[model samples]
Target chain A: MNTLIFRTIAPFLAALMLVFSVFVLLRGHNEPGGGFIGGLIAASAFAIQGLAQGVSAVRRALKMDPLGIAAIGLLLSALAGFLPFLGAMPFMTGLWIDLNLVADTVPVSSVMLFDIGVYLVVAGTVTAIALALEEKETD
Target chain B: MASTAAVSPALLEQAMSIAPVPPEHWLIVAPVLVPLAGGAALIALRHRPGAGRALVGRLSILLLALTLAANIGLFLMVVEKGALTMVMGRWLPPFGIAFTADRLGAAFSLSAAAIALLAAIFTRGEAGTGAPAYGPEPFHLLLLAGVSGAFLTGDIFNLYVWFEVLLIASFGLLALGPDRAELDGALKYGFLNLAGTTLFLVAVGLVYGVTGTLNMADLAMRLPAMEGVPAVTLAALFLFAFSMKAAAFPVQFWLPAAYHTPRASTAALFAALLTKVGVYAMLRVLVMLMPAPLEELSLLIAAIAAATMLFGGLGVLAERDLRRLPGFVLISGIGTMLAGIALHSPGGATGAIFYGLQSMALMLALYLALFEAARLAGTPDLMKGGGLYARHPLFSGLVLALFFAAAGLPPFSGFWPKALIVKAALDIGAWWLAGAVLLSGFFLTVGLARAYMLAFWHPQRPPAPVGRGPQTGQAALSARPQKLALTTILPLAVAALAVIGFGLFPERLLQLSGDAASGLADPAAYVGSVFPGAKP
Candidate 1:
């Protein structure tokens, strides 16, 4: 039942999708891209891997429980939101830290961190579902 | 596209120049945020089972205690300072999400946390998240977060979000223990509640469309000047949605069918907190936000209240299963609250608030008592065994107290609120409503008394004549503590004590509930606090 072509190209396609997901995640703060979209892309990469190899293969590749990853993402986002409390601001207030990198000064915001957390949560949740479905179908 | 439109540059500039509001009050968000953070942390540790179970249980208790303390402090602050409003990320009212801690919201939040804390402690004793198959901590914490959010939110859309959070947690909790019947119950519970929430979303959308605002305070100000029909329809929609959630009349079939399927502790927590949140939302939105429409529909609401009470009382009479009887009792309690709402008097509303709190305590105590009684009787069916009064006087006493309190007997916590509601009904000249309340209480008492006779007083063996003790062996009081004594009996005793305490000193509760009712009756303070310069 294995397709040779799908097995051959799955890893490369997954790599490309993973990289593109990060691109979408990074620009989500000010642009149209977002954690949700980025996570979908990453989840699609895992879905492809699960399809090409198996559910077990995808689990081995992730090296962490999907639900656990989702939990971490949720915690990260909450921590990002709570960071403003230290500054005596309301919850979910955006905080920025400017980093100087040799020739350039870059600004990083907690909003972006929250976006990343969302991305991880979305990816983890969707991938978990996909793997479960695939595993169930096989059984 | 043809560029023929003349756009206003000033409008664009005005929109661009609006700055986000600076954060002024940091403490306002603690009710929702604390539980969210705790839930996340608990989920993170979900995979590691049993090893750190005790530590996690302690941490959960500590976290809930902190939340309760913080909520009580916030409630006091709100009462002292009017309303505490926080606009998320400094956005102004009607634009950014608003979290307001008014008298009603704060009191409900505090009570919710208190119930959750006690439930958590009781659950820990039963078998905390330490048990692999029972009591997932994250869901419980998330459910608390959602309930807190529902009370604290000042925006309707945000309330929907919080409902989802709680609903998801509840679904997990509902299906937690192993019972094949639970699947059927969970399905019904899930679908009906989902339909209710869906209706709520549609109502929210309609309300937003008409008033151009989702903020509760802003809507209160804007809604009156708008057309009446849509507002009334929206009110009806809210009534349907919230009434379904509260499991009142006609729509209440789901409660008895499903509530008893969960583990006893889980059912107790659900019985205590879930429907009350729905009733709280109804009191907040339907009565406070849309008072005119509710008044217009008072006769219809009163009719429904009567029917709900009748149906619930009949169900209790018809039920033979001991565990399922409390579910009907819960439905009957919902009807009593609805009857108060139907009266639309300040007295009626105050009675409703007081009754809501009393029901929260009594329902938990009743379910926990059922667990103890069943443990002693060796069956969930009351007809199978008897003479609990002779064998286990302490537990039988607890059950009697809870039953009397629930039946609205004199000098118990339930009596004062029922009296207030009855008086309010008579004052409003809704004699039928008053009759229904009394009749329902009568039926509840009769039914419970019969159950008590069958389960506790009547023995399979013939009773000894006159004042002699039964020959079912001596009343043995073991020096050693029995199993589940700490886990089960302690919480039930505490709840019984609270009921007694509420009865002894009803002043503080009455005063607080009166203040909450006053706030609900008049949204002026709430509106003014939210919109500083808006004309009434």
Candidate 2:
């Protein structure tokens, strides 16, 4: 259980994975990566932290209850689906809002919000299960 | 509605290019979305104790009421103008995820929302009666969302997803009580239903593989044109899986075993809604997509119906627990629907659909009545709780009406549907189906009457100790045996009135059910509504 090398590298590895996860989540709408995969990556980061330290450390790092995070993610994803309803469209119809930056204008769609929500949902669910198992073993 | 083009010309163009979304399409998804969103929100606020749970609980009920209103609106719309169809994300049919609200789906959704609203209210009484793991408000919301989604979805895979959603929620509800019996029941319920859904998924895969599409309308268009045997096999797979879920015949064992394990009101909701959903799926898929195969399998279907009816009768006769008796009665109700469905006549289909809705109300009323009856006698055993008719006339009266209705007696909601089903059977010259229907009704009457006599009309007997000893909050029920809370009274009244309303206006229900059946009989209208320009 006392692997200094794993503990030392865990933080750096988790941090890198989290960054990569966000990158994947953002690109999910247009390309190969999406919320599900990105969330898995982020979850693996937390899982690695749990293995290196303990579930309490992972909980401290996340700074939120995993289930609460999952619930929020679900609400956000469902909210994304609801946006189109305001536009008088069918459920989950993609609606775009244009964001104008100083340099260029960007089109942000509800689909992106949906993807991020999925990412959080996946990450939260995985982290929750992993932490629960870790805690169970300690008990 | 600002002209965003003034700010950015290109953005305006992009926004304008999106088609003017039909305002009615929002109604189509409201039933599903309201519950989904509400459930997610409830889950987020789940950690909040007393006030939080209570607030969310009321909000969830309010949302269910809203969904029911939407369902009524959707039903009227569909009744006025055939089926309503919407494609998610604007993709065309066979390629897009589609949702279609036909009369059947609308009716089932409305009934589900109604049952859920009452169940949410009933849970107020049972709130702290079980393990906190029940997650009552959020889980109930999720369950309603699943039921609505299942009824509303037009794609086959989406139906499977909805099934999983409800199944998961049911598992949580089923295991809520602290009794080890609840866990045992949950395990059986869980594994059997998991296997059923798995089989359903496999059938969906096979059907998709054969037709290269999952849309119900697309499948209808392509299925008859493709090889016949594989299609028939797929239909049979659906029959098996849905039958298991419906707790029909050989598969009916799980219902009584698992159903009685939950808290009474929860068991009422399950009895009221769950198997009927399976029945709805069977009616939708088999009758709509594979009519020819259904004709071929009519004999098998009839046999299953007969067996389900007979088994249900025997189960009711054998069941000693008052709370559990309703579970077997529910099985009998499923049998009645199956018999109606097996006849494959318009009258039969109408009867089945009508009975499905009626039984939903009646079964819930029966369970709630049982809850009241047990509250009066301080026990759940039929043999122990006596002298109820002498004491609480109103409770006994409601229980009598529901029981008679459950037994398919005349001047009740159950009679009209049974009449339609029996007439259909006779018309189709299916003597066995007709005989089975009548005989099941007879057995149901005898069995229920026996339970009634033992529970209410018999000489007074000292009540047995309840499964859990006199609990704190609900313990007040036995103390105040002479009066019932309006919270408890309201749902039962709503359910009883719905039954009587349907019974008195059988023609209206018959017309709606008839329209629903016709849609199933000739899916051309359903398909056309989904694919407006496509040549049938």
Candidate 3:
């Protein structure tokens, strides 16, 4: 499957795809983008690499296991719920921060961060579990 | 611990004084944190595979043991201290995390914890052999997280979040046993329940819109002050949402189709807790927090409850699959409990509480017993068993007792709760309703008897015996003992004893639940328990 042209291009493209997925995840809270879409993009990147090289190749490329990513994302989201507890508020009340940027207000919040964590989790968990099951079917 | 998380003065003022702040809330909370922390630690230590899995298992067992012990401790504390409530982070009443420990909550928690503990033990036993390897601790941890979250969360929105927690964890559990049939169940379970959850979320949003506060105590406080437009709408949303969760009437197909596929222990655990969480939330928010909703649409709910009971009981009678029968019976019992709740009188409501507790314990006990019998008898095919009463006498005896408990036979806890529900309904001038409630018990008993007759006494056409017939055990290849290990034996024993003991000793539970019902009826008591300094 790894023809000469595909072999050279796959890694570069997958890495680019993953980085772009993070961008979507980070921007999810304010704009239309977020973790779910981001995770799907990242998974797509691995799929592309899988197509060009092999399943094992994609699995190796993503070192952090998908299940772990999903779990951490879940924890990060839950921790977001607990953030208020730390700030002497009730559980799950949203917290915000603002940075005086050159053009925009550049608002940031723990919720948005939590979404990013969710994004990584969704991306990692779905892809890993799906791919792992597919490999099992083959066996 | 005193740095910044003090309960605000204004919030305390809102919670009028009467109830003592329940210290036992920490006992429940500690078991919950252990798994949450363990999940985090396991992820951090993922590089050490052996250590991680071992830690997860050991910690889960240890945590479950501790939680069981915690329930025991909390039970003692409840007897000593009355109902209990805990406010997380010491925020003011409306702004903090509230966890309560009334007798009702303790009863449910103790039952659920017992189920989880048994499931943990069974999983451990299965792990050593060639059976399906249990999923990582995070899965069970997430499962427990959902259970604890459901048990402890005091607000509506937080309940939604806990629903999501369990939803995600359920995805893992469903997928862990992935196959064509399992996936079929998973997809249906996910889509349907997610819809129920989303419906609940919408209601919470609407309740917040109407009440402007998500806190149960705050809602109770504001409910009296608020006007109509959205209150009825909020109530409607709550009914629709909780009905779906409890699998009331029309929305229950997802349960029977999906539940039988999981590993037996997992199925039993889900059987014990999932729908009850819905009941608990409904009891918390609708009955206690906003009394008007419980009274207003109760007749409609009663009708739905009646339908749920009849359909479920009949559904169980029709099923030949042994595992599937109990699933239907479990669904049927939901209707019975709802009937108790629907009578809309205090007596009726308390009856619902007792029956709800009794049935949950009995249904779980039934599943464990049935699973054992099915494995021993093999084929679980109702048509093919004969004289097993002579072969597996002890197992048969347990099955008979569980059937009696499930059927509400006298001297069993199930009977008293069943009797109370009827009495409660009758006290409310709903003689017809009382009759239906009584009939539900009798109907379920009929199904139980049918299953018993077919399972042990019915003579097979071929007259199969040990020497002449086909295989009649879990493994057709061999007559494996289908070992009833300590884990299996212990939880079942506890449930049986609870059924018999709680049945005869109804007065204690009644007294306990009366204090709880009083505390729950007055939301102020719940609020005051969390903030002892608050005055009426």
Question: Best-fitting candidate, measured by lDDT?
Answer: 2
- DockQ of all predictions against the true structure, Cα-based: 0.44, 0.53, 0.15
Q: Residue A129: error of model 2 in Å?
A: 2.2
Question: How far does residue B256 in candidate 2 sit from its true spot (Å)?
Answer: 1.0
Order of candidates by lDDT, top first? 2, 1, 3
Tens-digit lDDT track for model 2 on B1-536?
22434667556443333465677767888888888888877777765556465687778788788888888888888888888888787666777788999999998998899998997887775536554533577888888989999999999999999999999888877876676777888999999999999999999999877778999988877787776447668879999999999999887778888887676677888888889889999998999888889988888999999999888888788877787888888888898899888888899999999999999899888888886787777666777668988887787888888888888898899999999999999997888888988998898899999988998898778644565654342354456545677778888989998888888788888888898999888888889877776665
* Residue-wise C-alpha lDDT for candidate 3, range B84-104, written one tens digit per residue: 665654444576667666666
After TM-score superposition, the amount by which residue B244's alpha carbon in candidate 2 deviates from its true location, in angstroms, is: 0.9
Q: Which numbered prediction scores highest in DockQ against the true structure?
A: 2
Flag the better candidate by DockQ, 1 or 2.
2
Candidates in order have lDDT scores of 0.81, 0.84, 0.70
Poorest 10 consecutive residues by lDDT, candidate 3 chain B: B125-134
Off by over 4 Å in 1: B1-24, B49-52, B127-134, B460-482
Best-matching candidate per TM-score: 2
What TM-score should be assigned to candidate 1? 0.91
